[model samples]
Target: MGAFSFLSRVLHTKPSNYSKILVLVSVSSGGLIAYAESHSNNETKIVEQSQPEPKRKRVVVLGTGWASISFLQDLDVSSYDVQVVSPRNYFAFTPLLPSVTCGTVEARSIVEPIRNILKKGNGKIHFWEAECLKIDAKEKKLHCRSNIDENLVGNNDFSLDYDYLIVAVGARVNTFNTPGVLEYCHFLKEVEDAQRIRRSVIDCFEKAVLPGLSEEERRTNLHFVIVGGGPTGIEFAAELHDFVHEDLVRIYPEVKDLAKITVIQSGDHILNTFDERISTFAERKFQRDGIEVLTGCRVVSVTDEFINMKVKATGENVKVPHGMVVWSTGVGTRPVVTDFMEQIGQTNRRALATDEWLRVKGCEGVYALGDCATVDQRKIMEDITSIFKAADKDNSGTLTVDEFEDVIEDIIISYPQVELYVKSKHLLEVVDLLRDYEGNKQGEIDIEGFKLALSHVDSQTKSLPATAQVAAQQGAYLSRCFNRWEQCKRNPEGPRHFKGSGRHEFRPFSYRHLGQFAPLGGDQAAAELPGDWVSMGRSTQWLWYSVYASKQVSWRTRILVVADWTRRYIFGRDSSRI
Candidate 1:
């Protein structure tokens, strides 16, 4: 009763005191809310800062040739940490290498630095100017050695770890263990090789004009012999002819009539890879240009002064005197590549064998392409058989037209090479033709008939040619597949659409042959383009220029090529030795 009476008296004491107390309570509540909000914001930022960054996979690419460069250009580097190892630090534009030998184009103009190319990428990329010595596939590592001069101060050997490995080390010139070939012959495969050839040609011209020289000596000094009938050999011969006629004739008249160019080919015809019409055309052009094309001849031995050949038609040994011999007799697997294949237990002796997806056989996380690898056709046949069995459903040994259609669809999804063949009505007609099989008592398409159908598709999708177009396409396809795989890994629940389908599967590589072109002398060229775009002469020459100019790997290189062409046109080739 006393406490109630005291509270009633205090409540009635003053209205001003009650208002001040209420204001103080409200201020304290506002301070408490502000502190709580500030603490929550600070905690959220702290948590974000403490979280770890996602790790990236390591991708190591071997060689900086056409295949490797194309893959690097198309790859999404942000998804992986990339490292490139090669004996060369720059990518040489091989097609223009012939021009370098005669000074039609500068050697440096065709070479692009690998570091410069990597600078254009969004992710960090490391480059090592080294040669890969061995591949430890079981450990996912590569043993490499410095290719730089031994006099230089640097680590001589090192090992690199990789989650993925790309083997693109290209082939080396094949001498077939011929005596004196490697020591005496000049190969036009690199920049230094072209420079050496140029110097040798100039030296030959200078020696031929020397006073008191015998007729035989002069003739031998001015003769240039090229071994091989491939595109490289033919193109080099053409360039040499142009250099002699257009430039050397004006500069050195004393030995003008002494120079001779000869090409020895083992095949029945030069440019045998081309169509018969094109081959005949090229041969006739060579004949008119005074460039002798000796078909059906195999080089037996090479010496400092002469090359001995065995003529197939005559079966007689012939010795041709020459001041310079250029060996472009095709390529063979390098020692490193051969060793890697052997170490990996790959059965292909000529090159590394790969499945249809370009994955190296008998190895994981390893892939091979370019001239170093060949697709295993037997494995592809086995895959085709598995696909056929899958479509047979109900454990039946034979299939109907509808079942065949299902198989075709499945193949189209898995093997992009057969997509074009399968999508057309021609495939349906093929199936209909196979429906009338006499051996099948069930009146259905038997396994033999399926195999026949696959054989037809196989012809269309067999081994791809070892060409720049095929290499570039393969690199692009692999890049796309890797990128898709990375994305699918990040999102396990995603569609997992990769090369063609799910995460575990990859679409077989499909090579599209764009065209083939070769330069003839006197501002003329020849091209066998797809469809009906066959062309030759000056028009084809311009087409060649435009195609190569646009195809230059970088804008800087394209500009330099254009400038070089213009300079050559205005001033003629620089014949003076550098």
Candidate 2:
């Protein structure tokens, strides 16, 4: 065993102080191999320390979203001074946000206090309820303001200096520069936003029931419009349909037929990112539910009581009156991230660019994840020559089948796109790509031929979608990297290089897609699992319930969510406007 390991085992103390002693003792260099014992009055003690302990690195994390929370939960805080800052003090389960809008699940049941999450981990992680305003990349400082003290203080602003900064603040709602969207539309990006939407939904029904309104006015007042037919918009429309038919119609029996829900999609179909079968099924279900789906149409503007759109197929201008509008199109970068990008010379980019290792390009000791950043996956074509040269060990101009086989694993590890390309082509192995069209299994190829064979691999490169699953996985991967940072620095642990000599210090981040769920309401759902498995219907809805309940951050939350679902089933969703 190494001296540090020996000292750590003998001490049996907390890792914070234990790591400090290991740093002070020159343990890895053999200075603390022997522990001298001193005796007095029949008592024994270890040798006295001759040097002071070095300070740990300060790691500042911004945001309490899925990414940041995952990082904190998995990180070993014994070696670093970790501090978390965000406007909210809780981590919300955002997948159930549509349910919250219709009271299927209470908002509080879906959120876990950041403090509670931290307490379950190492007690060293600290949190602050504040917002990050600016990032000084050159100086490694952050300008922040307290969210709670903004109303009482002269200036709630403060600064933080960090050795390493983690940017996971997530993105903001994108209005797409559409006119009047900011002033008239409600968004469903947060818990508070869902609560506001619920209140507005109740207000719409109450106003339509008022005696002063005519039949035309009542119809206009009861119309609900949702812009953007993505997963969020589709799910919201389904939930609203269920809410109205299952509950609201019974309460307001006079204007039962007046309620109308419409979904506007710029794309040809709702849930375009999902499987085509799933998308078709959703459209059919919505059609059967009397929900109007306007496909291939873009919203030009939204007013207080009207939304204007242009039909793509016929170039027809369409105008519709609505009581309320919910905007769930896409996400945009925050001001702080935009400013940081400019500081680091990343201009005209929608999101921050990061290396495959999750490190921000052109910056040192800083990393970004979640919706605010996109990984710039390296292309295989960029290093084709180096790879070919490295594989040709005998200085031969042509590479044989054996030589190609030896380096194929390394190539797949270093560049994931190669594996994806092989899968896309329905090939069993990467070596199959080396074969000719005549089904030649064994052959020798020159550099030019090798380049031609792999040229199309780069076309398979695609960006990861900004989702909670991606962010959570990224956080866990980064925490593992940080936990083993010192060990990996001393001895590289990643796969051997296909372009160079020595192995890489760490493996690049790769996303593992377990599966995704689309709840279609009315005891029905759809799921796209790994290995091209697609499932739909009531059984899938039960699976969705089990999966979401199990994925909660805490058992308290898991139980609460399950209880809320049970309560909603036993006694329909609480329709109180509160």
Candidate 3:
């Protein structure tokens, strides 16, 4: 019969006057298979059109920070029901937070609404503007409270049940229990904090220019003391210097020379986390810019008028007057995270601990990313016995050179430290680690020999830095794992199993360092790229601008940031308090 005749027979009627006709055709070994359907405006009924859909697991994400936002952006939400809860509904590009502090970039230009991010996908994702008060890991529930309007209703608190929870709420500024520090020092952690610092900077200049102010008083008021000479503090000092000499000095020339910027660091050098060359360059640049960098000094007490410090080298106390103090020391755990940590028996740990896969060790179905967690790498010595057994495929008590070579790839993939160890020791090959003390390379090795070879490998295990780069990479890694959760369950794709028979369901999380950048004042910057490459100077400053503009979460923010930078260059930073 003809194709039209077969289609008419399948439909059980002529296809004439049909409003819609659906045909699905597939070629099989026997013959062509076709599915035909006809719909009439009058009385046609679809044959069993409705089918049940598999229930999707609920994934509750906490925070709108780098890790959480990156996770949401990459996650396959069609596979899981996702809901985000955060006190702030917008994601801020935190790396540029220092720029925000001095109006080098506006705060609004660095933030994007969470809802706007979700609108890019077809999946329906819910967001609640609330803070997670408590996480009940035992019951898999969350207690959240909305701070929007607490007085309008009864109990602004609610509970949510989740199959999986992602904790990415970032850390709070650390004050280190210093007296009067929290009350007087300004922080640069959030957008609001930056705005506050900006207004304060203007206020310091305004008060200095007031009539009847003595030179000493004017100097004191114009003094800007920054605590903790980390990246945030250094950048702020640089930005403030530019704002002073470039813009503010032109407006208030009387107190311009009196304006002084001092950086107090407990460490021996500013940007100690950076390369020594970069740190030296930063210090020298600051000195040339007339920014005083006081190293080997610790701030013990900070008052409104005086900042008390004890010199680590001299053990002598010194008091310095300041108009404003900005604290960019470091991050500490949040209260909610602290409570959650206590519940999970992570009392001694500063940040939540996760296995190599990013799964919380004590709690099931819970994961952590960002500065709020650290990956606890398994020591090779702990698994040395199982590794030996796995390599001994012939049920022998020893491993030959061929046996060891067979599993070398899996070993490297499973424990990255093995490769690092070999490279650091300057060995020709990783297999050389198995050589006996007397120098026998191509020989059989017992369990003792295997243990000895890998015993020092654990020393190469280092925790990843808590940088935005690390957090973003971790978020992407976890999203890929979640996307393939079901597929990997049936067919494990991890490295070869050393403990048992089959491979792990998914590969462990691995971090690849991209690079880091530090912007010094005077249109100069420094970058530490991969492979120990360092670049600095005006060219690096342009690189910094390009990298920062490109790293914006949305093109709207990107354009806004670039516009802000251009506006600053053409008109100078907006020194108005507003």
Candidate 4:
């Protein structure tokens, strides 16, 4: 309906022009696109640019990511101003990022374009491809900076104002300040990271084929070193191992013999989050595949030439040169959160300290979720009578490992003869034949054996394996909360705000544990679902494919993904990298 609206649309499609438009338009307030036409009666009827009618409520969601996607799907947009802002314009199906790095899956295959996502909603959802740098709580506005490229916008920076805000910017790869790591090691947190890995890996191979290379020199030059024994690192290593064995030998035999891969883990065993049995299984499997698994090793420093790693076994340090070094350690708070905290003078250990409902403390009309914030899930922390602050927590919810230690003393008095065993024989697997996890990731209940063998049957459960299951479920949780919050706001007298926010008020969110799965490469996968179901091999992969197959954001995307998967299965990896 205004002058700037038309120009905005053009910039939306080809965002490279953002800077130039910003400079040209900065002379006026962000003018909306307007075109005037004269009527027969000398009256001008302005046809304002049309967008999907938004819901009555203004909900500006930051980060078009896992949590926001779920919220968008469930939100009745007819009542809210649903706006999404993020650096990337698409939702990257992160479980497949490792595959992207290994050249097994294309980056586009894992990314669902945001424009397509909104179109499928058939609603006018405003999108600002920018980073939210600040929040003016009193103004109830989101201050954002769009980095659409300086050449296009004349300046790389611009601002966006929003009404209600949801911060879902997820975590970033944490290096723990390892010396030289940030300078030399590559990370696997985004598509750019994956592309760089693939390109640099191939580039190294080409370099190794130089005319005057010695055998030892060539071998060291082609080695790949991976840090972290977590899911991402394990999965990437597995994919790389598969690529070398499956395609590299057949396609690039000249340097195949020189290719070596190693995984250095700081824990006693790989897959430390999984069951001990599973970790042992993975360790043996990696050993069998000629992949050096270095457990109990810490990386002290890394340089362009090689890395310095200390092993507890040798009680000394060692150095190894690698062509590619991928650091897949855990995640930490994102930059936006850190910046926000610094701006607000926050002292919470996390980027954003939130309540159970995921509302940022000291700020109203603003919420934070996903990896960027640390929510003391009021339900999970209600009982800490003498904790950091006055937050709602039931005594039951305040139970920590230290609190559990007190119970052991009482048990000792009740039953004098107490024997403790370290292992768990009661490993219960979920058996949901119809439900499948996205990555063949799994959830299993592993109960530890307790003392006082009178068969009282003590149990400790390790459920849902903190993999994609937790992430997906958390995403779904935020969606439900957003919808509920919108509804409660509309009614005003509606039952919202429960226990923690006030005295015996506010509804608590109960987390549901779903199944977990793991992709073991090639026509192979594994899943443990509810009801003691454990499946693997071709059958598991088929179910896994069909599960995520229906979860694509759009029908066109669904069809493309299916076609691509089938195409790859039949003809193999597109034989080209884009």
TM-score of every prediction relative to native: 0.84, 0.90, 0.88, 0.72
Per-residue C-alpha lDDT of model 4 across residues 1-578, encoded as one tens digit per residue: 56568655644443342322231333234434343333334343444444444446677888877767876767667666677888888988777778788677777877888877787457678777888776666677666777677567355455555566788888788888889889899999888999888877777777788889888888877899999988788888888887777766676778878888899999898877655555676777678778899989999999998989998888799998888899988877776677677656676455577654556777766777666766443221222223211211334433333433334333322212221211233322212111123424223211111112123322321222224445455556666655655655442112332223332122333344456556665566666676556666678879878887676666765677687777766766632344
Give the range where candidate 1 is weakest over 10 consecutive residues by summed lDDT: 20-29
RMSD per prediction, one decimal? 9.7, 8.0, 6.4, 14.4
- Deviation in angstroms for 312 in model 4? 3.0
Tens-digit lDDT track for model 3 on 111-175?
99999998966647899999999999999999999978766867778999999899999888889
The CA lDDT at 379 in model 3 is 77
Residue pairs in steric clash, candidate 1? none
For candidate 1, lDDT tens digit of each residue in 1-578? 66546545543455443232111111322331111112223231111112235788899999998889999988899889999999999988888988889988888889999999888674388899999999988888899999788998867999999998999998888898888899999998788999999998899988888899997898899999999988888999999999999889888897789899999999999878776667788899999999999999999998888898999999999989998999988778988888888888864577888876788888878888887888764333656567666778766888877777556555555555565555443544434535444523235777776776666555455666677777788788788878877866632112213224353345566566788988887888889887546688998899999999998888888898888899988988888777
Which should have the higher TM-score, number 1 or number 2?
2
lDDT of 2 by residue, 67-157 (tens): 9999998888888899999999999999999999999899999999999999955578888889999989889999999888556856788
Off by over 4 Å in 3: 1-51, 151-155, 436-442, 490-496, 499-505
The alpha-carbon root-mean-square deviation between model 4 and the true structure, to one decimal in Å, is 14.4
Task: Specify the highest-lDDT model's number.
Answer: 2
TM-score of 4: 0.72
- Alpha-carbon local distance difference test for all models: 0.79, 0.87, 0.86, 0.64
| Stretches of candidate 1 exceeding 4 Å from the true structure | 1-50, 378-385, 393-398, 412-444, 455-462, 490-505
Q: What's the residue-level lDDT of 353 in candidate 4?
A: 72
CA lDDT, candidate 2, residue 450: 93
Q: Which ten residues in a row have the lowest lDDT in candidate 2?
A: 36-45
